[model samples]
Target: MSPYSQEVLKYLNLGIESELQAYVFYKKVMEKINDEETLEAVRKLAEDEKHHFLQLEDEYDKSVRSEMWAPYRDIMRKEGLPDIDEHISETHKELLARVDKLKTKREIFEVALELEKEAYELFAGFYEKTDDEEAKKLFQFLMNFEKGHVLTVENMLKNL
Candidate 1:
């Protein structure tokens, strides 16, 4: 892979892995989530993350055509980074190292909200830099969904 594609894949995979991990993490946290409305929102957002995982997995599978993230899986695996159900695995260990620190229900929701905001901002930055229409569309969608997530978290926090 060219250096640019490799770089894109490495960074993009980190965000992708983060999303999948959040999906799994939220599912487990949902069991202990006390706020009914927050619980329902988390459930829905968890599903959204799963769907994003599937889309990214499909993109990874097509890396042969794009060379975007082909090496990500190997690096993530050798370093013991969590790979959301294998296919959407993270290609790095730095973010994975902090995964276990989210121990409480509120922490899970708050951290997820923060992560989503970071991802949305990252994608928004890329959306402006690259002329790729497909990527722009994907990032735009992610931004909107993440914006909604922030509102959800605000409501949950207010009630708490």
Candidate 2:
């Protein structure tokens, strides 16, 4: 276990929320798209986000029970994990507000690329913040997953 398990757990919770936001955003985007290929890709991306959210939720539960860690709500508040819900909601809002700008399939792919890049960087930071091998492996796994997402969106943009 890392000395900063509490902080790591806080980040994991934030990641969980972020993944859910991504899933919702992608689903909404799918509604706006009529291209079969783009719709299929967006559906797949939403499914990936759902899977990531479930994985993060399981990880958080494991961390909570593993070491008799105290409830972290107050610690997270004091440490200012920066209010995950609020921060992610603002991001979601920004993405929605850009729908007009993203009328083209390529433009939508570009927005997805940006979002995946953000997730990749965030997970990499979480990996660096942890001292535990288990936590490191988990974050590394997530970082790689997000990196693949970045590549997928970038490639989609190129093809569009």
Residue-by-residue lDDT tens digits, candidate 2, 1-160 = 5344788888887787667667656866776899898888888887787677767766776656542212222222232121334443465676657754666787778778877888888888888887878878878998888998898898887887
Q: Whole-model Cα lDDT per candidate?
A: 0.61, 0.70
Best by TM-score: 2
Tens digit of per-residue lDDT, candidate 1, span 1-160:
4323554455456557756666666655666677687778778877777666656655545653554544443333332223344434343343444455656766776777776777677667766765656666766777787678778777776666
- Runs in model 2 deviating more than 4 A are 1-4, 65-94
- Report the CA-based lDDT of candidate 2 relative to the real structure: 0.70
Candidate 1: regions farther than 4 A off:
1-12, 65-105
TM-score of each: 0.64, 0.76
The true-versus-predicted C-alpha distance at residue 126 of model 1, in Å, is 2.6
